[model samples]
Target: MGKASTVTSWLCCPCRCLFCGVLSCFLSVLACVLLTAGLVVLVLYLLFRPHIIHATAVSADLTNFTLTPRTWILRYNLSLALQLRNPNKRIAIHYHDVAAEAYYEGQRFAHADLPDFFQDTGESSPLNTAFLGHGSLVGGVAAAGFRREAAEGARFSIDVKLGAHMKLKLWVFRVPGPKPKIDCPLRLKRRNATAGAAGPPPEFRPTECRVWF
Candidate 1:
């Protein structure tokens, strides 16, 4: 009877050890699963998240358009006032650089900045120099690509002040939360604009302006 009892105790010890090992492994797996699930939930929330409606392109107008000779040899200064209407509840619109492009006779002639009346919040960043034209004064005719003399019968093409390849980036954030990036493209046209003598605006209009959701 003594030998039988010792054998029974040994068997029970091994069984308990095996059960403990299995329990530890199960708990570890459970923790890993919970961590993975949390990550997945966070990703899904970010992907489908809706952002605050800030500034939008309500209407764009160009006024006080003027051109004058620049001190630089053959260059001319092109200055124009840009007025943007934002129906969204935001106070100001942020542009990387907003400016106007002047196309004459189907060819790009000069680029100018949107009026500096629009203020930028960040000082470290360059003032939203919308066009190739620098702030304060923008040299027009003498720009690198165009000649000093205006084309005899050039038609004007007006586009938004951003650079040719540059686009607008809308930042979405609930302060203290991770900020997400949304890219919005602009659609600008010369409105109520008249052409020189007998010219119709060129056919190179943007197909559609992109808006973020």
Candidate 2:
């Protein structure tokens, strides 16, 4: 009985050692792979030095904003000039798609699609977008408030929202990622001092947008 038990223990000992050896080898290989991947990511980040794209609403024209309180019908013509800047010195930007919307009192009234283009490193470019024509305002309360403000012949405040999809180019390599939304709150009105003046139309002061990635 003693010899039989000794033989069984000998058999189990070798099997246990073999299983531990294989597991150790696999864990070692996995650790090495993970370390290598982390190093590669670090190197790529240092090489590209990518940065956020800055967008600013430089000017706005809202002279034709009109809203009917009875029917809640709105007729509007709004135009804006945006300044896009690539702040990265080592990377360029390739904008693939851009969309803009104008909102009054939290209600979206107009939208426009902009042409895709490329921006060089440390370059700034202006993009002009216009929202024309009109439809009924979705919210009655918002329309009434907007009408009252327009009648006051003072400033009308609205939000211009921009969304875009872009890629960063470093030399011949391209890195694609999601971009943050831009919100620019702007106030437009006839220069009360020049309201009745026989001269050019009034322009909204430049507005810096809020953005985060």
Candidate 3:
């Protein structure tokens, strides 16, 4: 009876040890899983964070610019087309408006409240005229005196200010954060006017547009 009791005691200790080992292993696995899950949540939050910003500019050819038949009205008005491009892996969600300045013959004319829209998500968009040059005089001839014939062989300079809001998705791996205001300057020569020419300006070819993120 004593021998039997000793054997039973030895067997019970081994069984308890095995049970404790299993419990310990299970607890370790649970801890690891919990840590992994926390890391995943953190990664997802970072990947999905919003409010990214960006800016860029694309200028159209000045020579291909158009003027109305009423050359008198054109002296004060100059229209230019521009393209906005997003080089990031994200979509350009919004624009903060645009500002442009034109310089001709040493006179500086500023234009604000330019129109804006989204372009191809990964490509370029149709040329858009966001600014129109105007003179102080109300459609007065020579107020700005910028007829197409007079503009021939003339040189001009442009300064552009652009603002944009961009975003990234979880699928995109690498993306840049908010960007600084984009500034661009360009020089161009006016085109010669042609008789009997109709339709949009030669440089006014429309471009396909889209946006994806």
Sequence-dependent TM-score of model 1: 0.28
Candidate 1: RMSD to truth = 12.9
Q: Look at candidate 1 and tell me the lDDT of residue 117.
A: 35
The pairs that clash in candidate 3 are 75-146, 119-210, 120-210, 121-210, 121-211
Off by over 4 Å in 3: 1-76, 90-92, 103-108, 116-123, 130-133, 136-152, 164-180, 193-213
Q: How far is candidate 2 from the true structure (C-alpha RMSD, Å)?
A: 4.4
lDDT of 1 at 202: 31
What's the ranking of the predictions by TM-score, best on top? 2, 3, 1
Off by over 4 Å in 2: 1-35, 190-198
Candidate 3 — what's its lDDT? 0.47
Model 1, 53-87: lDDT tens per residue? 22223333332123343533322223232222333
- After TM-score superposition, the amount by which residue 150's alpha carbon in candidate 3 deviates from its true location, in angstroms, is 9.0
Local error of candidate 3 at 171, Å?
7.8
lDDT by residue (44-91, candidate 3, tens digit) is 667544332323233354533333454432333344554545444444
Best by lDDT: 2
Deviation in angstroms for 136 in model 1? 5.6
Q: Give me the runs in candidate 1 sitting further than 4 Å from their true place.
A: 1-34, 37-40, 43-48, 51-55, 72-213
